[model samples]
Target chain A: MFSRRLAFFLVSLIALLLAVVAPAAAQESVTLDFYFPEATANNAQGIFEEYAAQFSEAHPNITINVVYQGSYTDNRTIIQTQTAAGEGPDVAVMLSTDLLSFIEAGTVVPVQQFVDSTEGGADYVADFFDAFLLNSVDENGQLWSIPFQRSTPILYYNADLFSEAGIEAAPANRDELVAAATALTAEGRSGLWFPSEGFPIWLFTAFQIAGGEPLVAERFDQVFFNTTATAEGLQYLLDLSKVHQVMPEGALSWGDGPTIFASGQAAMLVHTTGSLTRILSEAPFEVGTAFLPFGPAGEDGTGYGAPTGGGNLYIFANSSPEEQAAAWEWVQFLSSPEIQADWTARTGYIAARESAWATDTLTALVAEKPQYAVARDQLAFAGKEFTAFRSIDIQNVINTTLSSVIAGDVTDIPAALEAAQAQIDSLLAE
Target chain B: MQAALPVTNRSVSPARKPWSQRLLPYLMIAPTFLIVFLFTLKPAVSAVIDSTLKPARLAQDPPAFVGLQNYADLFNPTHHLGARFGGILLNTVLFAFGTVAIGMPLALGFALLINRRLPLRGVWRFGFVYPSLLPLIGAASIWAFIYADQVGLLAAILRAANPNWLGSPGLVLGAVIVVNVWSQTGYYMLLFLAGLQGIPRDLYEAAALDGANYWQQLLRLTLPLLRRTTLFVLTVSFTFAFQAVELLQGLTEGGPGDRSNLILYFIYQNIGERRNWGHINAITIILAVIVLVFTLSSFLFFERGGRESER
Candidate 1:
């Protein structure tokens, strides 16, 4: 009986050892952690998880772990804290505007290095839209991030309200914009709403670009806020509310603007194209989409621009080479034409790659819901968003000044712009 | 037998003792010491060191030692810091004191009422404490909806006025203060209730026998006895009020020309947006000094009160 028990124990122990060694002998695998912010509108997390699962199925030797971090700001905070402690996710989706900061912290590796080493690298790099590439590449021509989910500000108007007010079509220029807004303002509803609370500067950048003045220089050092064109743009925005009385009296929050527009409190709303899907489903009235109206200085129809807004995928420097390679594969898979087209159809975000728009899936989607095509067309005139040496500081200064000016508190537009310019200059000097 | 025991109690100087024997006490404390050192002391020291350096873009340029330059820039009127510092400080002070001034009395009244015999006393206590249990962010969101311009509860209730509670610069801070008071009063009431319960009932009975009215007894006995509790509650409330970030982030975001801006929000903006760690650490150090002074002064006042009571 003792001899039989000893043989049974040996057999069981050998079986346990084989169970552990079989997987290791079969194939080597790497598991990567991909962090992204929770989308405020669409069911982004579920779609992202599906993408990860699909990617894992395609590459059976590699695994992708999706972590839905909080908001963009919260994600940045987590990345900063984790990287400072010498550990962070293998890859993350961060704001394109924060690319400079990420590069500065030495936390992210340049995408060019990975792209150059990967198969079909040149074609992959060329697939992305040139407008979105502006924020991805630095002055030295180093590619730091790949555009994932991108958006541009667009005009959303109530077509029913416009017709009721006898407006023929959406506004094409500043003059028509003001006229349409004036006609739309009636017993209870305001005609226009531009949020001043969050990312006000993004909308203001659109205005500046439309007015024929880019806010910052190419070197990301100097700002042109003190220019006459910029002041005109600021005055135009302020006049919508203070002079034309076509908007709410005081400051309107970004979080509230969508609800107000959907509820028909405002006839027109200037917001990110990411809201297209949400607004379409929620608005009680017939929703019409159009490109932002060109400023007075812009050419009749061609010289208009809006800043690109959205997040990009970045690989961390602290990750192992194997992990980084796996992360690159995951990114490429996620940004492929088929996936990008599907993502665009689900979320209102524009496909980051030009080829994604040409995909049969996306073409069919655009035919079904043509509103998605307007934002893609506007990408032709899209410019670089406000990014500088200290982009956030510069943005805050401009946003604060714009908020005060729009609220009718700062009557002197040029003075306010000058103060903002000085602030940005000092930050750049630092 | 004693000799055969081999002198196990041999006298050895502590300096010559075994390493484990010498280190046992330190070993027992090492875990806590390491935690405090890593978390608290290390960051405090690093903040000081970071404050004295010239601000540099992290990866491109290394920071140089520039003593007091950050502090100087913060005070220079030509800079952004100098332009907004005074107003932010004033707003913080107003927010902290405004909540305390209005909230303490309301809490005291509720505590006094709940102390008396009433129907469903347990239910009344829970109802009084419910607001305190709600998360600040949730409360802020609710208040934001209430303060909305067109469809808000306030707009519906005050049909003629249509006050823009959070949008108007003049009224935004007051609106925030009202939310803070509403959320915090229950907590303070609980503290006051505990203090009220600790007071002996015989004292109130003796005062009644002496023909003292309820008002006189409360003024002379309850108020004097609750001094310690008041001090604690005030300090806690002041600290929390000064660090009001979640509510501001959720509701107003320090907008309408920075009318409702506080120092904590300013620090957060600097860290999250600006990435100017040197400036952030400088501001943090200054805030720490202010908090230290406030806490010390309160403790000193409490000590003096204790001494007087002893006399």
Candidate 2:
């Protein structure tokens, strides 16, 4: 009886061991953790999970652990803290504007190596917009983060408000924009209201870029805010507040302009093209989209240029080569034309791949809604803002200063800009 | 024969031994020490080390060990860190003081009113204390909607008289102070009432016989005896006011152009919004020191006052 029991126990233990180790042996899967700031509400979440599942099913050798690390700020915090502790996510999705510092800090690996390892490394849309690819590259010319989800600033107007004001079409140029905004402003309505802090930096940076001002040269370590175009951009928003009275009071307090616009309070809002899907769902009135109003010269005049607002995938140096390969494969999979089209359709973000828009899926979607193409159309006009040491905070301070000026708290344009420049310089110095 | 047994043969069964006789006490407390060391002490020690460095983010910039430079920069009036500390600290202190000043008396009043013979006192007490049980974020969100600028409930109500309740600089502090008081008053009042009940009725009777009026008795007898309880309430309330972030964050975000800005909110904005952890850590260390000093001073003052009163 004892012999029989021993044999039975051995058999059961062997079976249990097989049960535990069989899957790992069969698949040889590497567990990859991909971190993105995109929250659960963004359709990007669903697309990522689906892509992960698909990749796993196809390779049968990889498992991607997708984590929604909260907002962009939260993601940065988590990455910074974790990386400091010598542990960070294997894959991180970061904004292009924020990646330069990360690269400088060596927190990210250059995707160029992986791309080179693959076939046709140069084919990965090396030039995003005219100057954007250069802006995205680190000082070493290493592409630290690929632009997976890119967007530009666009104007979202209430079609119902336009109809009520007897306006037929959205303004294409600065004069037309002012006239439209002035006409739209009445007793209970404001002509245009961008979020106080939300897209002001994007709007102003675009204005500067369009006005032919070098915000930050590639080699320069600081922003050039002393230019006439920079001053003009600052004054334009301030005038919207004091001179035109077209912007709302307490705009400095506005966090998200779309919500205000959707609530039928703001007639027109300048926000990211990324907000289109969410706005479409929430807007009570008909929504119309157009490129941001051009500056003084009209359409050919200083036009709207925007910095990219979206996350790019980056592989961490801490990750194993196998894990890196798996991550890169996953990134390429997502960036492919098929997946990019799916992503664009599901989420409001414009695909970073220029070729993705020409796909049948995107073409069909765009045919149904031509407004979705604005971000892509404005790619030529948009360029990233000058990001240097303490750039993020410097930008925020500058934006706040502009916001203050627009809110009529600071009236002198050059003085406020000078103060902002000095503040940024001091921050950079410290 | 049993008495003559070898000494080595004698043994105490582990299960039969009493808990006091075993090393189980240390075993029981070991987990707590492990947790405290791992979670609290380590992070704090690291933050202190981090505070002495030049301000930068990204883990690779080896924190330059500039001893006391960050601290000096923090106290320097021209710097943003120093400027933020100056303004935000004042707001934080005012917020804490205002919350406690208004909340304590109101709580005590409610407690006293409820302690008396009144219908549905239990229900009223429950209703009063209910808000304290709610999460700070949810409560703040509700208040935020009510205080919304353009079409807020309060704004709509006051629109007839210029609509200046929440948005105006003069009224913004009052608005937040009201919310803070509302959230905390009930819990403190409940504590005060408990302290009041714990006092022997004979003391009040003796005071009454000594010709002490109700107000005098309250000041002389009630307050003096409830000093310990008052100190506790003040400490907890002050800490709550200092630490409460969700309410301020959700409600105003330290804005309408820095009117409602507080130190904790400033720290959060610096760290989270700006990703400037060095500056964040620097500010944190300063705030920690300030809070420590204030707490120690308050405790010392209270202890000295109590001792003097006894003398």
Candidate 3:
């Protein structure tokens, strides 16, 4: 009996040792916490989860835990708080505009670091669209993030309305646009709708760029809102509503613009490419897509530019080395040409990488759905979104000025622009 | 004998206790005090400290002591915030007073109606209080749809005029105030109902015996007796009005160009958008001081009135 008891104790001890040692002897497994905002569409989350599952299956030793953060704004807050508390996710899809904030907080490592250490680094970096890469890089030419879901502001018109108004085609220049809009404004319908709320600066930037005035300096420390081009551009926007009566009387809401256009209240709508799928599915009339109208600078000129807008994948510096490596793998997987093509097919966001457009799926999709090609074509005229140190405050000042200008509350465009520039300068100085 | 004698003496001199015995009550309260200090007092004190420092842009740069510069900047007309502070403050005051002035009487009327013997009293009470149960953002969204131009329910009903409820700068605050009143009246009504229940039945009977009409009784007896409840309701509603953010965020977003911007929303924007912690904390301190002064003055006034009544 004593001998049997001794054997039993020895066997139990061996089993415990094996339990602790076997996993350590095997390859190291990493689990990464991936955070992304909940997409507006229902299937987006499901698609992302499936992608994550596929990634995990291919890389058996790595696990990707996907968490649905709230909207883009909410994700900003959550990431800030969580990272400050040293509990940020390994990977997150953060706003491209928030790159500076994350960098200033010392919470994110540049994507260049990870890419350089990996295979096919140069080719991978070169694959992204130049417009997107412009926003992703800093002053020193360091790539801070990888573009994921990107978009550009494009013109969505009612072709049937244009035909009724005796317009031959979508406007290619400012003069043509105004003429078309004037003709379209009859009976109960408005000529055009430009969203004046929720990132008004994005659409406004297109106008400013078209007028041959970049709103801010490359370093973001200086703004030229009081310039002739800026004032002229802003005045033109105001004339569309207050003077020409081609648009809504007061501040038109960004959220309501799509709905209004879908209901045929507006002949033309200016919005992001992200809304293409929704508009196509919802619009009662045949939806037409066009590049935003060029100003004096013309199509090939520096004046005609639309800001590239959307979120990008960022790896947190707080993550462990293993976790960071695993996250980079997942990021590369998600950003591959095939996956990007699939993503573009599922959602209307522009494919971030040029190679993604070359994929058979995307080529076929653009053939079937020609509207998808407009945003891609517009990329040639795309510029960086307004981003700088304290960008939100600067953007708010410009947005407020734009709002007042559009509302006819601030009639003097020069004065409004001067005030906004002063404010932005002060913000940047601080 | 010795033990019995000591016990009797201990009972006679219970005040002369051991250290543990003396500290028992304090020890029992230590946990709660610690929690309060950590959650409430710590943040409040830190915010006060933060208000005195310059906002740090980079992690490498430690926050520098800026003295009263942030506060001064708030009033400096050359600065963007400095120019807007006056209007924002005025809006906040108007919002508070408007909500109270409109909300209190409506709530009192609701309380009086429900307190009396009536038909479907339960259903009516539930209906009246239902808005309070809905989340602020949810209610604001619903109101947004209702207030939407052209296609909204308001436009549908009032076919003659298409009023931009939230878009019009002049009408936006009043529209928001109406929504606030709708949400809070039910809560204040419940409070007034409790206050009314506490009032003696004989007071109304005595007023009736004196040939007082409903208005006279309400103005004289009910109003005087419900002063404490009204004070409480006013203070709470004032704080709620001052801290209004969800409605502004959901419906108007402080637009048609900062016409409806409130102090709390301003502070929130500073934090979330601008990351100007020092400036935000300064504004927070200003708001706190204003709320404190208002509350304390009201208390003092009430206390003086009570003393006069005693006299």
Candidate 4:
């Protein structure tokens, strides 16, 4: 009996020893906090979980804790506050607009050096879609952040309304658009609705680019929004309400143009291409996508697709070198063509990397649904987040001005535009 | 302050003074004072100091020393101060006075109605006070759903009448104020009811002997005796109504275009939405001063009236 007990004890001791040493023998695992800017309890978390699972399976060397920090504003504030307190996360996915500020604050470390240190880093050449790649680079010519989820502006319209109105498909020019909108506005529906408060920047950019006029002064240091071109653009939207009387009474206050369009209250809306997937999945009626309409005089103009607006993975300067290396590896894994395709399939974001389209998964997706090709085709015109305007206040000033016009509180387009410019210029000087 | 420490009366015997006896009072009270000092007084003192300085950060990127420039900027009338923030201040005052003005009378009336023999009086009192027990967020959420433009309870009511309540700016503030009144009236009614029950029955009997009518007896006996209660209700209701951000934020977020930007909501937007800490801090100080002056003046006026009446 004594011999039997001794054998059992010996067996148990060996099992315990193996259990304790197995983890210790492996390479040490690093814990990383990944701040997700657009994440909610909704679809964003599941997408991140898939990536995290794949990454952890491949590399037991690292662990990333995904934390949703509310909206862009909330995430930015939390990051700013934490960085000030010297406790920022190892990796943060923040808005492209915050790129300049992050660089200026010295909160993020440039990953260019890491690439150079690697064996085939030079071969990688740090490629990105022309606009996004350039935008990710700081003034000192150092790459600080990388594009992840990118979206371009597209005109979303109700096909049911268009066909019923006998509108010849979707309008491709300014005059065509005005006529189409007028024709579509009958009975219970308005012709077109724009989210003036939520995304005025995109609508304004699209029109300004098509009109062949500068939206702001060079260096973004001065504002010229009151110029004839912009005034005409502002007047174009306002005319729908004041002159055409084809728009809703409260479009100025609307933040969700999707709901408005889906409800069939508005026949047309200009929103991000990212919205395409949601509409296709959720809409009760047929939906259509088209390149934005252009100005009357300005033809042969390349459609302006602004650099996709979403967060990018960034390594904070406060992280240890080892942790930074691990974070970079995680970013690279996420940026891989297969992962990129997976991300696009799951989330409706266009692939940030050019090579992602060549993957078999993306090819299969494109073959299955031809509309995905429109987003890919528009990549050629994607413009970077205008580096000259390094401040978010510029957009705020412009949006407020546009909202005022929409509200009918400011009727004189030129005067209102001038007021917006003055406000922005003053903010810049401060 | 230093000399005030050793003021215990000599009538106390030393033999009765155990260490615990000497220390218990201080020990029990220390925690409350410490918490109050740490959370309230310290922050207040810091805010005052911070307010006097220009809205500046310190260190390698210290805020620019504009000394009093922020305050100067706030009071500048030629600028868009009124359009920017004055509306909020005015709206706050309107909301405060309007809620109390409507609420106190309704609460008192309900209390009086139920004070008499009525069916299921206990159940009625419990039902009236139930809403006050709910947290502001919980209450506001329900009300927000009720006032929802699309499928809300109030919207359904309006749809039965007419389907245009949510889209109109004219009715939007009214909708919010109504919710505020509903959530708060019950709590104040309970207070008034307690005060009414505490009044000596003899006063009413004596008035009855004098052939006073119900209104006359109420005026002579009930109201005069309920002065302190009235004051408490007014001040407390005004504070709660003035700080009604949950309902405002949950229901409207001060939108349909800043039409409902009450002072607290406006402050929250400036800080949370705009991220202009300087403006937020400046607004905070201004609001504190406004609240201080208004309450103090009310106290002084009421106190003076009381003294004059005695004379």
In terms of DockQ, which candidate is strongest? 3
Model 3, B78-160: lDDT tens digits are: 67677667778899999999999999999999999999999999999999999999999988989888887656789679843
DockQ of each: 0.45, 0.27, 0.48, 0.19
Q: Candidates ranked by lDDT, best first? A: 1, 3, 2, 4
Top-scoring candidate (lDDT): 1
DockQ score of candidate 1? 0.45
Residues B1-311 of candidate 1: C-alpha lDDT, one tens digit per residue: 54564444454565577565889999999999999999999999999999987645675577788888878877875576655667787899999989999999999999999999999999999998999999999999899899887667887788447766777778889999999998999999999999999999999999999999989999988988888888888888888988889888778888777778899998876676434667778888988888777878887898688679758
Question: Residue by residue across A291-310, what tens digits does model 3's lDDT show?
Answer: 88847635443234677888
lDDT of 4 by residue, B180-217 (tens): 77788898998998999999898889889999999998
Clashing pairs in 2: A206-A305
Cα lDDT listed for each candidate: 0.83, 0.73, 0.82, 0.68
| Candidate 1 stretches greater than 4 Å from native | A1-27, A297-303, B1-31, B60-62, B273-275
Q: Model 2: per-residue lDDT, tens digit, B79-143? A: 65564467677888899899988898888888778878889877898999998888877788788
Considering just the first chain, candidate 4 attains a TM-score of 0.86
Clashes of each: 0, 1, 1, 2
DockQ of candidate model 4? 0.19
| Candidates ranked, most accurate by TM-score first | 3, 1, 2, 4
Per-model chain A TM: 0.91, 0.87, 0.91, 0.86
